[model samples]
Target: MTATQSGPRISTEDFRFAFRSHPAGVAIVTADAGDGPVAMTVSSVASVSIDPPTLMFSASAGSSSTPTIRSAETLVVHLLAADHVELAKLGARRGAERFGDDVHWGRLPTGEPFYPDANWLRGRVIRRLDVEGATIIVVEAVEARPRDDGMSVDPTPLAYHNRHWHVLTDRSMLPPAVAPFYAVYGRE
Candidate 1:
């Protein structure tokens, strides 16, 4: 069933509010198209496929980094952990100095700027679709790099919901049923 089949048409504010209640993982996208580097925080990143390693994210026209990201051939998508909440805020803040002297970022051999501290995937822009005031970008992942800290465990992921940042941990997990699928499949 679609919203059009329902009683009334959804307003823009109502659409925004509905998504606000949904939790999304946070990511910082960085691109450098020969001029300089630009970064923006987004919660729109999602895995589209696993065979070819594809992902998609929407870049809003309102963001200052949108133009640079659109023009770049390749970009880095940094999946933020709870420890990098400050970096996420830096990318989300409008007009903030994203790559200052204090910021620890470096350019990849392929020429895209990236944060080495975060688990990131570098990908080539495969497709771009402009819809409304945002551009939906599809990328084919070429390489992925994990944090250099040598930690064997997964870091607590950062999330965005209702205009606030959140962290996802094992404690947040709900008790599973007696015969969980993962347990039956011999997975945790």
Candidate 2:
């Protein structure tokens, strides 16, 4: 146990271990704040609302791109599929040249840098909250662009768990188990 200003808190190692056991969808967030484009892979992206088309993700202070992403007013969130595992790894690698000559990326008409290979959403940062050492960004999506290859149907989603990347496939899915209350309410 660790003591914080408020009260006893879980050890950092314990907190990390708990979260590491949980799987999360992978996304690469890109932004350009005049100097140049910066990209970082994140597993914290989550949908917050549908009516307002809002989403949120947390950027760790340790990431090299966190400052750029925090300062940029607009950004592109690439919802990576299993085919984008390499891209995910590239962005996650510390001190890696994300936009080097070999990498294929382009700027959206709206001016934010984006990876054309993955499905992406262009949005403006609506809110920024600094919690602990991480910055939590809330974006209101205005435009979405799917991949040009038309592979949208049932694309295998990329996920991160226990410090490893995994692809969610049909074979990995378990049979549906409905709760009694939900089943009585006609919910699947």
Candidate 3:
């Protein structure tokens, strides 16, 4: 939602309402410029201009990844797999020790670190739009799979709403289940 929304300075409730209104695909923005690695959960990530193969994501000023994200001119936006919720949470966390030998990490030709389990994308930061409330970062995709896991799009996407993480799976498409709340938020 646009900040101005055809009007003036909105109220705090308006912002909260806007944020809760939509279902957003959760993503973790990753960065590592020699001082270890860092990442954060951001729903603000989106494709800006396809002509130049560009995209962008915003990070809060108070984000622990602020310096790392701002310092590097590039980053790796890894779309999490179904089983990677823990990884997503780990990345979003602040001041946690990152990079375990158990988790996969690799380098691109340009020396960019990436995770293999990522739903496939390696991007480079292009420019930053210094807005009043947030930093609008623009990026260009350098490496990504045209078809991840041989699928045009993921069968399920990791989603977040109402302060909870959800697995939007194909099973959700099934007709009414025994659960009550399940009747409300239809699946798929």
Candidate 4:
């Protein structure tokens, strides 16, 4: 048992602060609602099982898009490249502006529109888990492919740390190939 057992419970602010400091790759979790393209910025997207080709992402309980994403049968999780940091902010913003004309989107074979350039993994909804304050979307990968011109994951990732976007480059840390687990996006 650690200090957590005798808890003065971790404050949400403190938890968020700690979580923010730990770098995470950003992804755009998207789907098409009946009306139009819908997506949200999610740092929690990840692969949970390889056997079934599964992935998961959590959405805030209060997000309006949560309902839409949950109701949809499938979704596309787009891995953000180093150059897509600005687009992450756009998806995270709260308002109709997120749906404005500035965004470029297209449909998948399922006719579900997604942000075309964000680099994606299309998945079918497997299950939904209602966590404390958010709903976790566990989806099984139906198709995993990169956008036509998307770079293979070897390019440096754009990460979020301390609530700011960062590029992973120390030149010194640049190896011929990144470690296997760190390979994200379309890098296989």
Give each model a TM-score: 0.88, 0.91, 0.76, 0.81
Go through the candidates in order and give each one's C-alpha lDDT: 0.93, 0.93, 0.74, 0.81
Residue by residue across 1-78, what tens digits does model 1's lDDT show? 866687788799999999988999999999998889999999999999998999999999999899999998999999
Off by over 4 Å in 1: 1-8, 146-152, 178-188
Alpha-carbon shift of residue 143 in model 1 (angstroms): 0.9
**lDDT score at residue 44, model 4, on the 0-100 scale:** 90
Candidate that beats the other on TM-score, 3 or 4, i.e. the better one: 4
Weakest 10 consecutive residues of candidate 3 by summed lDDT: 145-154
Model 3 TM-score relative to the real fold: 0.76
Clashes of each: 0, 0, 1, 0
Ranking by lDDT: 2, 1, 4, 3
Encode model 2's per-residue lDDT on 1-188: one tens digit a residue: 43467698888999999998899999999999999999999999999999899999999999989999999999999999999999999999999999999999989988999899898999999999999999999999999985555657678999999999999997897656633665778876
TM-score for candidate 2: 0.91
Most accurate candidate by TM-score: 2
Deviation from native of the Cα of residue 165 in model 3, angstroms: 0.9
Report each candidate's C-alpha RMSD, comma-separated, in the order given: 3.0, 2.7, 6.1, 5.1
Better candidate number, 1 or 3, judged by lDDT: 1
- Residue-by-residue lDDT tens digits, candidate 3, 1-103: 6757866887888888888867667787777777867777777778788877887888888887777887887788877656778877777777765566766
Candidate 3 — which pairs collide? 172-187
